[model samples]
Target: MGSSTGTARHSFRRRFTIVVALVAAVAVACLLPRWWCGRDADQWYRGDPATVRGLAEEMVAFEDDDDRWRAGGGADRVVGMWGLLAHQMTALGLAQVSLEHPEWRDRYAPVVTRAAVKSLLPQLRSEFTSSWHGRDGLAELDSPDGHAYLSYPALALGMARLVDPAFPPHLAAQHDALIRAFERRLLASPTGLLDTFPGEAYPTDVAAVAAAIAVHGRATGTDHTAVIAHWAQQVRAVQIDRDTGLVIQRMGGDGRAHDAPRASGTGLAAYFAGFADRALAEELAAGLFDQQRNLLGFSAIDEYGDGHSGAGDMDSGPLILGISMSATGFALAPARAFGHREKFTRLYRTTDLFGLPLRSGDRTRFATGGVIGNALLLAFLTSGPELAR
Candidate 1:
């Protein structure tokens, strides 16, 4: 009996050791390839626009429902809309790039614009008009918490305007109303920076306000210069991390700074560049854009650099740690449009590829995912801003 008991104990120990070894081996195997492939920054820029365009189209085609559009199969969500809109706009920008590389433009622009109008636009408008009470003069959107869920729609609206000029007229009244809603519900005193909402505020959503403000400035060409400037100053005072050039993800209405820099917040650097110091935008871009890896590896900061933290709310989609293509793409594209050439070039060289070889529906899906990627490439293709003589 004693011998039998000893033998059983030894068997259990052996099994446990084997299990541990297998687990460790599997983990290393999974991580080793990524580590090996991740080192080459050049791998990021597989700059074939035709391939990129095809990916964008695939993303749009994969949308089984008007409401649901994620890169991988997922439910219809806000980020999908934002991602689609940004993707279409990037394609329009890429048209100029396709001018030189005519092969890319002929394949992408027609389909991209078509997708924008037929699919992306309608969903965005519905979200604005129906889901949110923006059209009903109900300043704040009707969400569970009673906020308009401003950032995502605001960014989408801004992008849509670029895609279709008529979009602004259709939504103008609502647009102005949304702005006023922001003022009444989300604006905080002293700083004048808007919050996610009046009481329950997200510190970083103020950047969304900044984005809306910048869009208004560009779209209307008036009434926004001073307002945007003031908001940018107020936002910078409360949220910017001077040392790292990152911004706090959120702050209390009472004006205390939190310590996390969201991709959305950092991404705004390029959009907000025109209103604030150009150098600051450069700093923010540098701190935020990690060009060292591919899609799964290129995310921006989640709250507190939490390894597995994500933007799962209305503001973002499933986040893979260490890279945020969505955020970095948004930042780089706008930076390019606004004439931050050096930053644009760096981002372009580092992150200029999308789903290639046609594994999916349309290449614009990759374009949508890599909106900044297209934007950077487009900027390279377009004429540069003239320097002071």
Candidate 2:
């Protein structure tokens, strides 16, 4: 009886080991694709120029569809906030693409640049439509002193200058006017920042506008050193979050910093701030790194640095295991820009796994993301040297 029991136990052990081995094999098979695909994070950054062009081409198509949605399907089809920001970033991406591949100007000028100017520029201007408010309600984009609409105009026009010397002279005139508007807004601000929604200013948006002004200066051989110095000082004085030491999310026009640092605003502001003050950009990025960095396998950013989940908004998108998806995705731009290669690589890998990309013919897009998401992704991937003087 004892011998029989021993034999039976050996047989069961063999079966158990076989089952364990099989399970292990299956797991490896399932996980290998993700590892192989994502092992090299820079793969996305090394995209073909033609593919980059296709993203811009595809964006125009998507924008038309969005307009149609607003016109026919749902009054709620309106895009706002981050969506509008992507509209501006898309145009900025196209501008950078045109600059990097000057030989492709023939294709870029009319297809990307002019199309962007015609469609998205007006959207950013918010002509009778609302971009700062919710989709259900049309909030006018008419903050005279510190309007958010003013940010992208400066960015798109400054980028337009890089696209072609023959870009319309009137556009350049418009660029100067926008800069003047920004200057007026800056001088008028009690807090030294510009507002996106009325009475609410975000450091990220203001930093972008500041960078655009600097880019325009470089493109036009005009010096904006004095203005930038004053503006940067104001930002430092009022925008830094005491807890995290990075830029805050929203400040009142009366100058109260409302939220602690997060990946979304800090990343974007830092990327653009590099144009005006690389030092400031570096400082913010360093602070962000100390607060947000998660170095286990794929890098992730905590939505709030001090574990404070103060409030989650559409801008933060969905949080994954306490990490903000939008913050992680959007932060890729500045992270890559500032030479945070290891972290950038990990973030890009995460983006790739979650992005659900689609590729056909010459075009590649993230299936799960809308026009804004893809546009922002394109902006992150195709970023090149600055036009900054």
How far off is residue 248 in model 1, in Å? 0.7
Task: Give the per-residue lDDT of model 1 (tens digit) for 183-241.
Answer: 44444356544434434345445545555555554556545555555655765676665
Number of backbone collisions per candidate, in order? 26, 0
lDDT of 1: 0.45
Model 2 lDDT tens row, 221-314: 8887877887788877878776776677778877776766676677667667877887777777776666555543466666677756666776
Q: Best-fitting candidate, measured by TM-score?
A: 2
Q: Scored by CA lDDT, what does every candidate get?
A: 0.45, 0.67
Model 1 has a clash total of: 26
Best by lDDT: 2
Model 2 lDDT at residue 6: 100
Please report, as a residue range, the 10-residue window in candidate 2 with the lowest summed lDDT.
Answer: 134-143
